[model samples]
Target: MSGTLNQILNGHLSLYGDLPPIPIGAYDSGLNKTQRQFRRANKISLLEHLATEGWDHFRRQESVATGLDRYHPTKLPTINPGVLTSKYLLLVIDGTTHRAQSLAVTGGWEHVVSCSLANMNSLPNLLRDYSAEWISICHASDILANGALHALAGHLQQAKTNTVMTCDDIIVRQLWNDGLGYEHRQYRSSVSAIRLCTRGGIGGLLTLDYSLFKQCSFAPSYTCLEALRLDVLLQITREPIKTTHCHQALVKHQGSKNPSMPEQGWPRERCPFSDKQLDEIDRIKSQHAKQYFGIEGGLKPNPLQAGCHDLSRPTDESSLVSILIPFRDQVELTSTCVKSIQQNAGKSCNYEIILIDNGSADNSTIEWIKKAIKEDNIQCIRLDEEFNYSRLNNRARQLCKGDFLLFLNNDIEFVSESILDVLLDPFAHPKTVAVGSRLNYPDGSIQHQGVVIIPGERRCVLEPGKHLKEQEVIA
Candidate 1:
């Protein structure tokens, strides 16, 4: 590895702690022996030349050949190619408006620049001006860690062919509550079949070489930039282009705020979506789904499963469940909760209990939990902090090794023996993601059957009396 590239790798390791060992020449292994040797020789020569002649002299030399060739009619002034020796353009697009922000100057990047989705034709012109070999397109609000840029640069340097790279982003959602004020929730992105069916492919950041960018520029008249980008990406699957995903959350998406749209309708000339255009988009998605997931007709199985099932377990112990319950100092309630699961669920059901103790002051409760762990009856996780319902469940999820995860409250007890069977039955279908059971008070009156949004009320209400019968409800 070159000194610069090695430094970049070390910087990433520092920020993320230890990372898995990366295979050397993994990107270029496909190249023939001669091609690989020639490329390496050229890279070494270029590095040596850059070190001796300085950037300005190299830029001036490349400028002499600018007017000799024109790839497109929208020709722009070409910068000295040497200026982009070690840099890659970081193109940040506004997710809502599909317009690029001029963040290059602020980021102190000579090659990076923003552009509107409609004028993506001018991308070729911009690339020519900056002479950037690679470009990374991401949302304007994405917060990149310190070493993210270096990692991307290193990837571009090692990539043998035209490649598109994507990484998971930490999605942060913010909401204003009437009583609690502003609330922020952060979670890792988990793209599921249901989400894909509704929203389409991983629709976030993408990095690609300039050659691939030219092939997949935004359509000038496309109104929905998100749909257009997805289509473009899917279109490339037919070609020999390589696509890869980085597992780490290199970018943080500020999903709480919407970008300001241009006063003039997007695309400058707001084109109405015709029926034919809409159909074409759907057809493209269908093709993508079939090619990628082997699902015909681009349709997911109906996740909704209605009707009750008799309390029975399959001969095979495939349906293992992890019951996660968060507990504090209430030893009596916690003990009762465990006993209820044991009695109602019975030995027939394949389930394990995960008790999360969050700063319990009572010694009796702590000792009992420890005893349960020692006996191997239940798994106990200790958290010496205040109660955070979201964090507690999120942490417990990592420890769970079940096919299905069930989250419960310590104060609640299972009332019916058939509840687990009923809930597990729905998940037999591939589309069913979550199942909620009816909650009843001690008196047997309904506490919550389902939630109903009253149109004018501006608040959703727990339907206490209605939706009593077994039926499918819109989430």
Candidate 2:
């Protein structure tokens, strides 16, 4: 192990862990004080070299090329790249692996730890998400205490710097509110899921359990974030943060059940995944890979495949859909409603059914669902208010992520093909926000145009959501 890891770890434990914070100046990877040490230890003649050279000396591509090109006759041509992503002129010492599944964005001097493992394919998904400005693949196998120190030393001795900056442009987010915690939830089954996946304690990247590799923990803001593409960790100046909000870590919807909800309504509180989270991980990966990357052969490395699930314990991740069923204790109707939804919902999207029990006689509905499928996908929300349809739907919508929401009644039965691709196609357009369908009673008479919001009224009662052409609604 490199001495770098020990010093950093000890410094971390003593300073941030149990000891007081280190009163050090700013610490970024590229222009770090440590890197300066590496530079100093290495080429002391670097200053002389720079003094004798001009800007043109660094700009030429010839400077970066490996002189020993004749060694491996079959090796693919390597691009000795330099990066200007941050104000600092980040330079790439090496390039990432040229894996077919692994995507390399043009332009950068950064390196990803994903290469630490040999069998692991290419740079990680998070780095690709950014198509990072500058990065390279220099796999560091040794977990040394002074690993950073050595790397800096190597850089100084081995290579010369074209330009050094005061700091980096952006930093990988590892704050409490970041999504790393949420992503790992796919690894958990019950409370265990919540604990293992929580991002608060993990602090930064590259150090969590297998869960760190999963994409769910990747915050939404971190789109196109390939793990390799990320710049080295920044050592920032410290300042106290003022927290605004904290999410109720895991949903404890058991006691918070709505008063009106009947016994046979929603699923019970168990875990996020049914037969453990591992079952659902790959599914989530495959589905998402198709969505973003499409069937194209060459692209970036597909995201990690651990949080997705199988049929026995399916996990939903296509686009999150929240099914909010607001009902009074009509057990029979509730069962019928849930059954219909479960039957019709084939695996194109992730569906979460939140049953808001307005007020019910018994609570069998939640328990029955729990037994049937401990899919962390489902939730039973107990509402505190009476059956105010509009309010409940609004609340659910806020939580919903589906491109289009499905508001089904306890009595309504989907007899024919549900909105697959054609009917709700208008939603593809940004302007087409809501679509009204032709609603019909069991006997086939027009029950609703799918909506009719009276003057100043809050609710838009479904006039119809059945078979109808787009023009029919316009007329």
**For this target, which candidate reaches the highest lDDT against the unseen true structure?**
1
Query: What is the total number of backbone clashes in candidate 1?
Result: 2
lDDT of 1 by residue, 1-475 (tens): 7764553232211111111111122112222344446557766542232233222232333221111111011111112222235346777654433333334433334455655555666556666666566677665665554445554555456676667776544433232233211111121232233233333335245566666666664555443444555566665544556655555545544433322111111121112334444454555555555566444334332223111011112333666789999989899999899888888875555888899989898889978887778656479888887789999999888888888888999989897885566566434333345666767777654567532121221222322133233221211
Write down the RMSD of candidate 1 (Cα, Å).
Answer: 23.3
* Deviation in Å, model 1, residue 339 alpha carbon: 36
lDDT of 2 by residue, 280-305 (tens): 33333333333432222211211211
Which regions of candidate 2 deviate over 4 angstroms? 1-317, 363-373, 397-403, 418-423, 449-475
Q: What are the per-model C-alpha RMSD values against the true structure? A: 23.3, 27.3
Please state the error at residue 58 of candidate 1 in Å.
Answer: 55
Candidate 1 Cα outliers beyond 4 Å, as residue runs: 1-87, 95-109, 118-124, 177-204, 221-225, 256-284, 287-475
Could you tally the backbone clashes for each prediction? 2, 86
lDDT agreement with native, every candidate: 0.49, 0.31
The alpha-carbon deviation from the true structure for residue 458 of candidate 2, after best TM-score superposition, in angstroms, is 20
Write down the TM-score of every candidate.
0.36, 0.28
Model 1: worst 10 consecutive residues (lDDT sum): 64-73
